[model samples]
Target: MTNYDSAFRWMKVKNGRLHFASIELDIQKNDFENKIVDDYLVNGFKNDSEGIKPWKKGLIRGLEFTLSKSSNFWTIVIKELQAPVLDSNPAIIGYTAILAFIEKTKIIIDEDDLRKIELFVYESWKGSNADKVPNFNKLIFE
Candidate 1:
């Protein structure tokens, strides 16, 4: 059992350009409705029995950018997260070519680690520099 063990679900499309919008699975509708009230984004996996420390948010692990079609994504131009180390491999490049897998799985997820991954994946979609992403799009609800 690790407090740093978390998973995320996200979606993306190549409209004018490739865009990514990822959310933690534990996130509820209230998470979206209340987002405006307070800017707090929560990552639900970092609070329990991870064996070590279990509470130090910094000691946890999480996701990183997996892929992008943009040339800047790999060729050392965008050395954001794992880009510096993971880009040299053709396998990783292949994983990124199809964006669907990246949408759901974070390469790494730690307990309460969703927020950091959210900032990297979700908040980027919210930026003025990026395209607009609706809180709820094609994802179905019951």
Candidate 2:
């Protein structure tokens, strides 16, 4: 068993209105509701399926969300980012765009933030199914 097998506490966006990943992800759903609504992003919602006219929007938003999530990886290659985006674009996808917009500025979070994120993830990693055989909750991530 690993420490992640049991996440005692978590710090999350509160209540940002995700399409619904796992119920456990919404620890402070009400608190971050505004942020969530504003971001209005999701993940894994690919198009070419769903057959719904509105599905494309969701798919695009999900792709953005996925890109944003991947942006955190840039923190490891901090030096590669230029300068303009260093101040803005906290989210991963936004940072990528910011770099594209700016001529010379790339973005990278410092080691401290990376460590914090790492610790947060470590502390957040509860087992998939530990409490009950079919515990059907806690899969939501905000």
Candidate 3:
């Protein structure tokens, strides 16, 4: 097995409901996150991880394509957005669409790797004039 031969459960929307799919993928460890964080610190904007995006987008795209053989590549856009979904006490259904699927999956990654993902995502959402991601100071957790 390769270093990143790991399994993660993925979910997609179909017929106004969630469709579950599982697959094993190869996740190569890299300094993508560290670089993003570093760039954010120095330049006030993180702009690395072009290498990791393909790997991540490919996994989500594959799962989405399997659910529906549509010819749209927007799934990658949503996957990369990682937008903030309000965590309410009752939890609104439609509003939590993307997050619900993500919370159900189990992926194997070292702390460093996980940290990288978090950093990259944070930087993406943290808003930078260079990237136009507006620092929305919006807290996601309730």
Candidate number achieving the greatest lDDT relative to the actual structure: 3
Collision count for each candidate, in order? 10, 13, 1
Point out the higher-scoring one by lDDT: 2 or 3.
3
Task: Compose the digit string of candidate 3's lDDT tens values, residues 70-136.
Answer: 2222221122222112211111111222232233333222455334433333333222311222111
lDDT of 1 by residue, 46-90 (tens): 323332121111111111122221112221111111111111111
- lDDT values, one for every candidate: 0.23, 0.25, 0.26
Q: What is residue 43's positional error in candidate 2, in angstroms?
A: 10
Question: By how many angstroms RMSD does model 2 differ from the true structure?
Answer: 17.8
TM-score of structure candidate 3 = 0.22
Query: What are the runs in model 3 whose C-alpha is more than 4 Å off?
Result: 1-105, 126-142
Q: Lowest lDDT 10-mer window, candidate 3? A: 34-43
Q: Which residues of candidate 1, in runs, are more than 4 Å off?
A: 1-9, 12-108, 131-142
Which of 1 and 3 is ahead in TM-score?
Answer: 3
